[model samples]
Target: MNRYQSNPLSLFGMVLWLLSPGIARADGHQVSDPMSLARDLVHRMTFDQKFILLHGDLGVDFHTSKKPSGAIGSSGYVPGIPSLGIPALQETDAGMGVTNPLNGRPGDGAVGLPSTLATSATWNIELSYAGSDMVAREARSKGFNVLLAPSVNLAREPRAGRNFEAYGEDPLLTGTMAGYAISAIQSNGLIATLKHVAYNFQETDRNFYNVMIAEAAGRESDLLAFEIAMGLGKPAVVMCGYNRVGTVWSCQNHDLLTRFLRQELKFDGWVMSDWGAVKAPSDANSGLDQEAGAQLDKSVMFGDGLKSAVRAGVVSQQRLDTMNENIVATMARQGMLEKHSSSGQPAIDIKGDTTIARNVEDEAIVLLKNDGNILPLSAQKRLKILVVGGRADFGVLEGGGSSSITPYGAGIRIKADGEGEMGRRYVDYLPGSPLLELRKALPNAEITYTDGRYPSMAATLAHQADVVLIFATQWMVESFDAPDLSLPEGQDQLISAVGAANRNVVVVLETGGAVKMPWLHDVRGVMEAWYPGSGGGAAISDVISGQVNPSGRLPVSFPRREADAPRTTIPGFDKADGAMFDIPLIEGADVGYKWYYKHHSNCLYPFGYGLSYTIFSYSNMNVTHQHDVTVTFRVRNNGRADGKEVSQVYGLFPANDGKREIRLLGWVKSGLRRGEEKNLSVTIDRRLLANYDTKLGRWVIPEENVMLVIGRYAGEAEIQFPLHLQRAEFSSLDMVKPH
Candidate 1:
C-alpha cells in the first residue's frame, strides 16, 4: 500500500478495490487456472444463488436496461449478481451463422446465411469449422459465451421444415461435419451446443407429436447418427427436442436425458429445454439444467414453477443442486465471468466469409441428369434458352426460422423482371431467386423468362427456344408439415406442357427436401438444386451450363410414391388436432434409406443417390476386420470432362435375430480427372454390426454372416461378405440401465 500510494493511479485503484468488495472479487487478481477459480466460486455460492446460476441468462443485447424479461417480465437478460460476484452467461442461436435479432421496426429484415445442406455439400470440414468460428467470434464480441449450433439431426425427410438447418442424412458424414463445427466454435473460447438432442427429424407437429419408433430402428437409423455426432462434437450443451415418444416427451424423458445421453454416450454437457417445450413440472425431472427461451405469454412459468416444485417436493433439492452445478460448471469453463476490453471492430472478415460461402456453394450442386450433352452450354450464338416458372425468377433458396441469415445491404442482385413480386407478400421469409444469376452467367445466350403459373401460353415460346429450363419451387414452413411430395400446384402442369412442347427440356428443382417427380419421365434433364443459399443461382447456372459438375447426393430417400413414405400411416397428419397432433413416427428408426431398404419398398431415388455429368465405377470391395469391412473403389470420369464422385458403402447384417435391411456404415468422396481413376476406402465398425434385440432387450451380435455392399446408392453395387459372430451371454444391462 505504501508503495502504491506513491503512484496516483495505484492509490485510486486501491481505494476502489477497498470500497467495493464485489469489485474486489471481480477484479481479484486474474486466476490463471479457470477450473480452480470455478470451484472457489461455486463453494461460495448460496443454495438460492446456485439455483439462479442454473437458470439461463438470455439477452436482446448487452447494454439494454431490461432485466431477465421476455413475456411478462420473463424475457430479459440474466443479470450478474454483484453480491455473489457471479457473471451471467450469454447464449445465442446459430445453427448456420449469427442471426441478427429483428427489432420491431419496418424493414428490419433478418440476415440469412447458406443452408446447412449447402454447408454439408462443400464436403469441407474446414469450411464448416471456419463458418462456426466466424459465428462464434461475432457472438463472443457481443458478450455471448455459448453458441447453440451444429444441428446434427439427420435430414430424414426432404419436406422437413428444418432440414436445411441440419447436416445431410448420412450419420458418418453429418457426424464428421458437425464435429468440425463444434471444434471451431469451442476453440474460440465459447461453448458450442448441439441441438434437438435425440430423434428430432421432422417438424410436422413437432412439439406434441409422438414418435413411435422401434428401439432397433431408432438405434440404427436416427440414434446412430446422433451417437456419431455426440462422440465427435462433444458439445458443452445439449438441447432436448419437443417431440413426444413412447412413454414421455423427448424433453421430459429421463431415460433419454440422464440415462442415455449422460451415462451411455458420456455427454458431460448441461441440458437445456427447447423454447416452450417444458409441458409440465415433470419435465424438470429429466435433469434439465436450464429453461431457455422462457416466455411469460405462455402458461409455463419458470421461476415460480421451479421454486414451487422444490417447495411441493415434486423436484428434489439434490437434483436442483446438480443442475445448478452443471450450469455453473459450463459457465466457468467458458470463462464467462472474465471481462476483456473490446476491439470495437468486426470479429469476422467479410471477404473471407464470402470466399468460403462461394466455395461451399460450388460443391453442393448435384447434377441429376444431362442428356445430349446440352450442358456446359457452348458459348455459341445459336443457343436460345427459355426459363419458365415463377420460381425460376424468384424462388426461396434458403429455409426460414432461426438459421436464416441475411447478408449486409444490397447484395449482388441479378437482373430479372418479376423477381421483386416474389417477395411482395413474403418478403420477410424468402431468399433470392435463381433467374437473374442464371441469365448473367449466360450473357451470350438469349434468355427469355415468364412469371405466371407454369404452362402458360408459353408452349409456342418453348418450342422456339433451343432448350427449355423449368424451375420448380416448394414451400414448407415451420410449425407446419408439408401436405405431400407432389410438385407445387402449377409446377407439374408446366413441366408436362414444356416437356411435351420442347424435346430439350430441363427441370431444376428449388426445394428444401425431396419432392415427388411425376414428370420425371417427361423431362430430359433434372437438377435437384436444394435451397442453394445466396449463391444458389450461380451454383445452378454453373451446374446446368457445365461450369461446375453436380456432386450433391440425396441426404434422404426420395419416395417414388406418396404412400411409400414411412409416415404415411401417421394419423391426424392432414387433420387438425389442436396442440396434440397425431403426427406419429410409426416407422421408428427405419427412416429414409433405412425404411426403404428394410421394407424393400421402391423409391424414386435411394439415399446417397445422385447422378453426375461424368460416369464413375465402384470396384475392389474387400473386408478388413471380422466386424469391419473396407470397400475400395475407383471413380473414373468416363465423360470428356472431369468431375467429383461420392462413393457410398452400405453394410447388411444377416437377419439372424429378425433384423431389418442393410444399413449405411460409411462413405468417401473422390475427385478425379478425365480418364483418371482414384482409390477409396470405407470402413464399418463392429458396433454397427450389433443389432437391438427387443426380445432380449439388448444389442446382440448373432452368430451369422454379415453382407457388405458398395455402390453409388443402396442395393446398387451388390456384394456379399460374411462375418461369423460368437454368441455370448448378452444381457439387457445397457438397454435397461442405459448409462
Candidate 2:
C-alpha cells in the first residue's frame, strides 16, 4: 500500500510509481528532478539563449512572420538551448489526439479518443489513464514533448462551445478523470498540460470578457477541480486562459497565477499563456513563464517588448531566471534534458490505441431512455432496421476545432463558414460509419439508410423498417457558443417526421453537449453518443447491439429548455467587438446539478442519470462519519441480463451561514451477473463536503446534518441517509486528506 512502491498486481500502483516525481533510481539519482538541473542550466545560459526559452512560434504558423526553424508545425514551439542540453519544447494540441492542424504534416494522422466529456462520463479513472497513455505514446512517436490537454474546466455552461473538450461539470469527477490523464501523459515522459487555469466558461469574445465570481466560490467550484487535478497529476504546465478572471487577464492576474495556482494549489510547473493570450509586456512580470505563439498577440510582448522591459529594469533578472527554471524543471522532471534512447521504446500501437478509444466510448454512451428495454437488438428475430441522418452511413460526427483528427479511414469533411481559423471550423466526422457497424452487428437483419435531408422522405423510409434510428448531431467548437440547446439543421423536424411514422424510433445523439428533445415522448429510445472519436461508430453499435451495456452517466444536466440554465443567453453574444462583457457567476459553486437543485427546477435529464439494458436496485445502505463520511450499500442486478452499473452517491452538505455544498461525493461502477448482489463502499471525498471560506481563508466543513442519497441520478433521492457531522476546517486542502 506504499505510494512510493510499485505493486506489480496493481496497475494503479505502477502508474503512480511511473509518474511520481523525485523517485530515486538505483544509482541514487532522482529520475527527473528539475531543481538542481534547471538551476545549473540557467546559470550557464546567455541572454540570447534565455530569450529563446522565453517565447516561440506557433507550430501551425499561418501568419506572415517567419516560423521558428526548430518548430515542428504542431501547436506551439520554443527552441532548445543545445549548449545546456535543453530539448525544444515541441507542443501539440492533445485534447483528443496528436493534432496535425490543416494536415500541416501531410498524410499524418493519429487515433482520437472520445470527446473528453465522454471519457469523464465513463467515471472510470483507469480507462481515462489508458486512453491518455495511448495518445501520449503516439505523441512521443511524432517527437512532441509538451501536450496541451486533460482540460479540467467545469462544464457548467452546456452551451459553452468547448464543453466537449473538457471533462464535466462536477469538480470531483472532472478533476479525478483529468488527474489520471495527466499522470498517464507524464508517465510516458511527455509534459502534460493542465490548462485554462481559471473560469474560461464561454468562447464568445473570450479575449475580451471576464468571468466574475467570488474568490471563495471559485475555489470550491472551478478552482477546486484544478486543485484536485494538480494534487493527483502534478502536471508539468498550467496554461493561463484567454479570458479575464476579474479585472486582470488570467495570464497577468496575480491571484490566479501566483496566489491560487502556485501557492495554494502547489503547482510546481510554470504558467504558459494560451496562444496569444498575453496583452502587454508587463504581463510577463505577473507570473507568465512563457508566451507561446508570439505572433498571435498584438504586441509580441513576450518577445521584443519583454527584452525592452528587462533592459529598463521593469522586469528583474531574478524573475526571468525563475521563469527559466520553472520551464526547465518541468522538462527535466520528465527527463527531457537527458539523452534518451528510442532503441528500447515500443512502436506506435494504432490498433491497440483504437481499442482503448472504443472501450471508453462503449462505456460513455449513456442510454437516456429505452422504453420497454427495446435494446440489445434481438439477433434471433429477423428484423428490418433503418438508420438515417447525420451521415452515419459514411462516418460518425466529432466536435470541430484543433482537437479533431483526420482519423484512420478519413472519409469526409464539411468545412464551416467563417473568416480566419475559427471561421474555417468544419463540421467534421471521424471514420466510424455506424451504418456499417450496425450491419456488421446484425447480419441477419435488413438495414437501410437515408441522409434524412428531407423530413417527409425520411418519414416514408421509416415506415418500411421494424425500427428507425435518427442520428442527430449538434456541432460545437472553439470561438462560437451554441445559439441554443436545440438540434440544428432541421434534424429535429426530421426526427419528428420519422417518429410520427415509426413507434420504435430511437434518436442517437452525437452532440457536443446537451440538446433539447422536443420529441422525447415520441421516440422510444434516446442515446447520448457525444462526439465519439475515431472509434465512435463501433462504440455506438456496441451499446445498441448489446455487445457492451451502457454505463455512461450525464456529466452535465440536460435542461428541459435553454431558459432553465443559469445563463439564458451567452454573456457577450450580442455585445460590440471591443466592448468588454462580464459573466457574473452569482450562482457561484452552486453549478450544474447543484444550481438546478438550488432553484428547484426540473431538467429533462439530471446529472449521473443513465440507463442499462438490465435493471439494478439498491438496498442495505449504511452511512458513518468520523474524520470522513463513509457509505456502504448493497447493489443487485435484478434483471436477467448481465450488465455494468454506475452507482452515484449525492450529498447535500449542511448549510454553513446560508451556503452549502450539494455535490457528488463519489461513485463506483461494477459489473454483476444476473441476480447477483454485491456490497460497495465509498470513502467520501471530504473536500466535496467542505466549503471554501473567503473571510477565514480556508476550507470549512460545517457542523450540520448531511442529506445523503444512493441514487441512479441527481434528481432522485430514492435511498436516503441523513447523518450529522461536526465542524472541521483546513488551512490547506493537502492537510484534509488522511495521512
Candidate 3:
C-alpha cells in the first residue's frame, strides 16, 4: 500500500462602535461577516502594508529579541497598523496556563491548569472546555488576544520531551479534547492555536531533523489528529512544525500545506510557522501564511526576503493575497478587529480560576492501584502518619518548559540543568503544600514530615509511623526528554527504602508523563497526580481522604521499562548537534496501547485504565451500525458509594496481513449513585473506524467482522459484541460535535 492510502475571516470592518468592554465575549456570531470585511480591506491595504501581516517577532527581550514600541512582551508579537485599526496579536504560552516567561510581568501570573496529559486522562470533554475557557478569559484579561496552545499533536513518542504538552496518544482523544479547548478559548474572543503539525514528535534535534514517515502512517497517526481538531475547533491559526515533514520543511511542504490542510481538510485558517521554522522566501508559495518569531531565524525569511521573492516572481501575488486575507479574516473572526485591548486590563481572578483547576484535577487524578482498598483513609483516625519527600512540605512539582505557569500567590523556583533559554531551565513548584493540605484533611492524624533526601531517614520515620505517605516527583521538560522511565533524582531508591520500612505505604506521583514504579509491590496504593496544577495539593487530599471519588484514567500506557518502548532509543539522540538526520517513523498507526496490543506485551498500566473506590459493572450491550455506530450499555454501581465511571470502547478490525488493528472508537463518562443503574450511549464517528487508503485518498471501512470491545480500559472484555461491516468509504469527515 502507498504511504498515504487513507488520510486525510475577514470581518475587518467594524471600528470603535463595537469596543464596549462588556461585549468582549461577543464572537463572529454577533459581528459582521469576516470574509466580506477582509476582502474589502484587501483592496485598501498598501503594497508594503500587506507584507507586515506575513511576519512577527519574538516580542520579548529575554534573549535580545527587541519588542516593538507599545507591544506586549510575550512569545510572539505582530505589530498592528493604527491607520487600519488592526490590533496587534499578543500571543502567550498557554495549554497549561498563561506562563510568565522569565517573570516578564513582575508580580503578574496565571492560574495553573493540570498538564494536558492529566486533562487527557480525565476523558471529560465538558471539563476540558470549562478549564480552557477559564484560562482563555484570564489571558484576555491579562492583555493577550492569542493563546499559543491546545497542541493537538499525537504522543507518537512516549519519551518525547513535549509529551506533557500534548493530549495523549490516541488521535480521537487528542483531537476531540483539543477541539473543545479551541472552541472554549475562541468563544472568549481569544485565538487558540492548534500546533506542531505532521510528526514533530520528538524534541531531540527538533529544529534540524528530517522526519521521513510513511505517507499513510503520517496521514493516519499525527495528521489525523490535526485533521480532527481542525474540523471541531475551526481554529484561526495553525502552527507548522520546525522539523521537516519529509525532505521538505513543514512550513514549505506543498503536500502538507496546500494539498492536505488547505485542499483536503478545508482548513481555511492561516498557517503560522513555529518560532524560527521558516527556511526560505519560497515558503510562501508552499502555503506558509506567516513567519512567527522572525527574529529567531538566522535571517528574516519573510520581511525583505519575501518582498524580494515576490519581485522576482518566485512567490505569486495570489499567494501573498491569500496570506494577507487569512491574517485579517482570523483577526475579525475572533472579534479582535472589533474589540480594543486595554492596557489597564482587569486583573486575573486567580482564586476563582484555581477553583476550576481543582475541579478538573478532582476528576483527573487517576488511582493506579488501591491494593486492599486502603485508600479513602478516615479523617477521624488517630493513627500516626509519616509524610516523606517530594518537597511535600514546601510545594508541588511541575514540569519545566514554555507551558510552565507562574503561581499568582507564591512561586517556588529551583534552577535546573540544560542549555534552554540562556541556561535557565528552572524547575517550578506550585504552591499549596500537599503535607499542609493533608494536615487539614486529616486533623486528627499525627503527621510528621521528611524531605526524603536521605533514604535512611525516610526509612526510619516510615518504620516509626502507623502508615506512610510518600510524595514522588519526576520532572519532564522541553529541549530534553527523560532518560528512562525510572523516577529521577534517586527518587525510586527513596521510595524503595520507605516502602520496605512501612507496612502500609501510599504513593502520590506528580509527574509530566508515565514513570516506572520499581516499588509497586511494596506500596499499598498509588495515585497518579500528574502535575495537578494550582489545586494539586488540595485535590490529592480530597481523593485520598474520601472527599472525592477517583475517576481519571491513563491517557497513555505505562510500559514495564524503557526497553519496552516503541523506540528503545530516541532517533539521533547521539547524532552530531548541527547535522541533519533522518527520522523514519515505523510505528505507523500503532502508538501507545496500540503498539502494546500488536506486540502482545503487557504494559504496567493500559490506556483508559484506572481504579476507583466503588465497583461498577457493564451489561446489556447493544450495538447499531447504520449511518454511524452507536453503543449503548447499562452501568450499575455495585458498591455502596457513589462514583463516576469512564466506559471505553475499542474497535477491532481485520488487517490484510492477518493481524488486526485496534483503535479507540469512542468513550462515555457517566455518573452513578450507590446501587443505581444508568443507561449510557456513545456514538462512534465512522472515520475513526475507517482506514486511510493512500491509493484512493479516502477513509474506507473494508468488509470484515468488526468487534466492539467495551470496558474500562483497552483489552478488558466487559462486553464484547461482533458485527459484520460493509465496505464504506468517506470522501470527507463530519466534524459534528460528538455525543
Q: Which candidate leads in TM-score? A: 2
Residue 480 in candidate 1 has what lDDT?
45
- For model 2, residues 1-739, the per-residue Cα lDDT tens digits are 2211111113563456454543322123464446877898899988867788888777765847655687777878888888778888889999888888866677888898999999988877777888998998888888888899979888878899999999888988888789788878877788888889788878889889888898888988898888777767777788998988887899999898887776766666789989989888788778889998888888678777888888999988898889999888777767787776545566778888899999989989999999987787876678899998989998788888778877765658887877875667777788879999998988889999999889999989888899988899888888889988889998888888888999999999999889999999889999999988878899999998888889898999999987888889888889998788788897888888898887888999999999998889999999977877788888899998888777888897755447544688887777788998888777776777887788888888877788888888885776889988788888654632210
The 10-residue segment of model 2 with minimum total lDDT is 1-10
Error of 1 at 17 (Å): 42
Give the range where candidate 1 is weakest over 10 consecutive residues by summed lDDT.
1-10
Order of candidate numbers by lDDT, starting with the best: 2, 3, 1
Alpha-carbon shift of residue 587 in model 2 (angstroms): 1.2
The TM-scores of all predictions, comma-separated, are 0.84, 0.95, 0.95
Model 2 bad stretches (over 4 Å): 1-19, 22-29, 341-344, 420-422, 656-661, 733-739
Candidate 1 residues 190-210, lDDT tens each? 777787867777766576666
Alpha-carbon deviation at 225 in model 3, angstroms:
1.2
Instruction: Give the whole-model CA lDDT for all candidates, comma-separated.
Output: 0.63, 0.82, 0.82
- Model 3, C-alpha of 164: deviation from truth (Å): 1.0
| Number of clashes found in candidate 2 | 0
**Clash count (model 1, backbone only):** 17
